[model samples]
Target: MFLIPAIVLSQRPFLIPHPLLATAAPANASILLSGVLLSLVVIYLASKCGAEFSKRLDFPPVLGELVAGVVVGVSALHLVIFPESGMEASDSVVMTVLQWLNGLTPDALTNVFQSQSEVVSVLAELGVIILLFEIGLESDLRQLKEVGSQAVIVACVGVAVPFTAGTAGLMMLFNVPTIPAIFAGAALTATSIGITSKVLSELGRLKSKEGQIIVGAAIIDDVLGIIVLAVVASLAKTGEIDVTNVIYLIISATAFLIGSILLGSIFNKTFVTAVDKLKTRGNIVIPAFIFAFFMAFLGNAIHLEAILGAFAAGLVLDETDARNELDALVKPIADLLVPIFFVTVGARADLSVLNPALPENRAGLLIAVFLIAIAIVGKVVTGWAVFGQPGINRLAIGVGMIPRGEVGLVFAGIGSASGVLDKPLEAAIIIMVILTTFLAPPFLRVAFGQPEEPPANGEPSLEPAAVVNEA
Candidate 1:
């Protein structure tokens, strides 16, 4: 009969409807999208609550963000499961409970978290790119020139001492490889100008010579840090550590930066003119972002990091008539993306590594504690190096530079991505970042001798201080 023939045809492999087709094609896509949205909401809420609590307790908001990450991340409550090959073979008690509760196999759970983390990672990458671009936008060549010699000395000393100390310490004490140790040193070199500026501004010392020196030194430190990152990342990629290779990397990175800036500066006006002819003048952000992405691509082509390209893009645009407009438009995007970066970095921290009962975990904890001490001492030493400002409180300046904040986290994230910083090491790095961020405010307050803020007669004083963004 016709019914029998139809049933036989339907039973064939090709006759079967696809699962998504049976529902809607977007069913899987919707689930992934929903998962990402829900995850962001959760992370944002936790970060806000944590930050508010920290502020109430007189700590930086980043401490709260890290706390939020640990609470939801892989090593703690595991609320945000990560898919790792390790998880497939893991006899982890927590993983078992999660698997059973979710009615999934270990493999399935790993796949799910892998998918989730991938989405988060991409957003986080964007966050760092936007951050560096903003920094480039804010760098006024005149201001840096004004600070001049003193700032240069501080930056050089600050970078050299920490780079040497961190790399040597990690290598000698932890037996870490040359590559990982170098990356750790690079991570230690950043001074969070944004965080330091806030404390100085609150104390009404932002216009002080010490403040100018600190800001100038910090700007220099950023440029140095990025270059160092370039060298280390290059070495890690090449798996070479000789002096010849080292020199080559440094020269290459410096040339790339110089070339990109010069080229961008030369053509920026023409590029803007062309873009202005487009419909995006009403929202120039579109062209602004395109330039950033294009530079990023060029950086990749030149064996430099995309971040440098993004930074170059910002440097070029900073000179344009639309500089302020670009900042205004890009800032909102950065605000949304930057927090996602920090929170995701925090989530990557392996809290299990801090467990005292496990031998390895206890060792990791010791490493974390040691790193905190070194991180503090490393930056504090630079405060004393402000020889030009003999009257400046060396202690205050050093304390001001101590907080690693977002910048340190960015370094750590890159190290991990490059396979130089393992889970235990990254956890240690995160611990250091959190503690330094928390400690700097209180230490800086004491160093500055907590002034009672003068009453504001109008709007707040218009003085140059660190740009304290939510990032």
Candidate 2:
């Protein structure tokens, strides 16, 4: 009778157990939730701040987003605090929720989350592809033609130097496998064209000779980066480097470029002709998106990056005629989706694990700093590639492409997924991403002549020139 009473007392709702009992929920779920919430809040605040800040500086709002992330991440404020004790508690809660949602066994929650992460990753990839396509649509091919040789030189120099520096730096510091080092090098090759373009536009130089060169070079850089990625991925899969395969990839990329332009030109002519004939009443955005997706799918079929397809599709659209409509259709989707992409990036950054105290960890941080320096120097060097143009600051143009942007993160994600990068290496890359992105805007404002304050007469002393090529 006494034992039964004790058992009944233990089962009582008000019964107090150990203090630790209150911490039984899993911590990872809490951490994830915190990260998500914090990221969203930071992005919102940063977006507002960026609008005003960007007027005085020559950079995109994404730079501000990166700065906001760094502030919340381990780099600065360390605000997204996750206690070690909370991990078990958070895990338990997450497991229970997962089991309830999918009828999964306790043992299966890990697998379920992994599966969910994969799905999210695929969608993120799709988002990037669409983003790239939109960029291509906004691209001016005529500018590329005009800047052809100079752009080629700038891109080649830009890619080669940083890639070599990154690979060598990793090999010396980490002693990692050759393949992983190669991937690391490849990751350094990207230039966030969006950020560069935004800065150029802000400086009222987007139509200048230097601006055209930077833009053209950025497009080529994307092409080169994708080709390198394909080769690295193929090597990762095969575990052996095949010279013939690498050659084939290059050839295939070349073919894709030529073919895409030819096909896109024909398609653009036909589509615009149809739009004219049909006088379609509804918005053409859906059709445009469909075409973008179609091109993305085609690129995937060819083992090319889906973004290439989106870009080709964009190139096909007669931007001169359809610019306003296309912009209206795409901008809304971009506005909604792009922030999610950046915030997701911040949320996914596992900065809590990074320890700068340990030698290996310190090495990783140093590697990040070294790579950033290399990235900056490499682009600056490309400015010297401009010949017979003394007035044009090729250095400024090259420097403009230093920020790695979304594509760099995408590369890091691929490396992380492929096991080419361990957690520390991944963390290091994230730091590099944040640093390059955050530094560009302010520096770019200085590099490009800053816009003077408006005159009292309501007209600025210097008027922004219309779209004109500087000889």
Candidate 3:
């Protein structure tokens, strides 16, 4: 398949007289197009190397991609520095990597790359949207329904304990105001469902009873996390949290989710027949992918995370007859983009917030460390809250829920952008997320015991018949 720029430029034009020519090369040369492409190459290479290194050490590949981003991002190498700091970036020995590859001095280099990050960030968000959609495609609604009660119970405890603990820890001890405290607490919610599922898949236990429980609880946690983020973000954005507005936000989110799922599922199957009449053959997932983006846009308009909408779209289509074909098409797209999302997320972390020389920042660091502890114990306790399934190892379920990778970053990123979470708090949250994310795979590995080695062929093939063209 062709790369992304063509898709991004579609259906858009510049001046009325010069529409299609807008995409043609400008009269003067610019290095930015080449720089961004090279940046992606560096990012992909760094991510794969890091991911493989982590896998060799019995860790999840997500953790490695994240670390690689930080190592090569503004936080470490200053390979992709901002223009303001580029003048004084010489202290970083890793700056040489950027110099040797791109062949530009720091300040000039930064100016060239800065314009590209905004575009890269937009693409990264798209990557995450695709990931959530792919996850939804793979999930079974009936299984989620069966575990609803247990999931609700565990999700509530998981959200509540950490939120209260995180908020209070920041407020009472550090004298943090109401808004940042709330953002800090909200970050602790939402166990990384993608990370947990990956670990379970590695262990080949996703079909197990324990795995089912964890998946259900994580879904519920996503719902609860959305509500908390909505409420807290409202308080931060408006500087006033009315009881009625909070109620309205909750009701609106709930209604959107329920209505989307019901109407989406109905429309998915019924409309496909009508759409097919105008159809070109072998284009099943084109409509599915477009609908996923529409839902994501709708969710944003309603003040919830886009992933929630994308996820709902997944659930809507999972029960349809076209599920298999849609999944086959979307998986490759997800695979191509998901690494960019994860790597950019890590690389964007600004480690300067934790500098000890800044007296005020020290308190935030302490609060971060404290929040990490609370985040772990909070999720761990949920395992004990499970009612049925006596044979299930509750600890494994708890450990599975520990990683807070992408979802936690989404919450923190919004808070930082909205001016609710300051640099220290945002950086601290990033550290806490990294630590929490790193712990989960090792914990799951130990809890589930060692995995057996693959046969002489190394591993089985992933390509299915549907993924290949039948000439």
User: Which candidate has the highest TM-score of all?
Assistant: 3
Clash counts for all predictions: 0, 12, 0
Better of 1 and 3 by TM-score: 3
Query: Relative to the unseen true structure, what is the C-alpha lDDT of residue 432 in candidate 3, on a scale of 0 to 100?
Result: 80
**Candidate 1 ranges with C-alpha deviation above 4 Å:** 1-28, 81-108, 148-152, 166-244, 260-265, 271-282, 364-369, 387-397, 400-434, 437-471
lDDT of 1 at 205: 65
lDDT of 1: 0.64
Q: Write the per-residue lDDT of candidate 3 for residues 177-197, one digit (tens) a residue.
A: 888988888889878776676
**lDDT of candidates 1 onward, in order:** 0.64, 0.60, 0.68
Write the residue-wise lDDT of candidate 1 on 1-471 in tens digits: 000011122222212332221232353444445556667876777677766776677655655666677677766655544443134313333334445555655555444344545666667667767765765565554454466677778777778887788889989999988888888887788787655654565455655666667766775676576567657766777776456644654576567666866776667787678667877354578878888888877765554455666766877787788887777677778767766755665666555655678765665577788778788888788777766454778887777778776566666666676678887777677778767765776787778775434447865443322234443
Q: Candidate 3: which stretches are off by over 4 Å?
A: 1-30, 80-112, 174-179, 206-209, 237-239, 271-282, 351-361, 406-427, 450-471
lDDT of 2 by residue, 1-471 (tens): 000011122222112232221332355344334334443455456445644464345345555544554454334444421221122222433334445654544434443333333333344455555555555555566765677798889888888988998888778876867888888788788887756765564456655678778877776787677667767766776777667756765686678767877776667766666556654564477667788888777765655556666766776773447654675467556554454444334434445435677666776686677777877887788888887677887657867878786566666766676677886676677667666766776677667765434457866332222221110
Candidates in order, TM-scores: namely: 0.71, 0.71, 0.78
Q: What root-mean-square deviation over C-alphas does model 3 reach?
A: 7.2
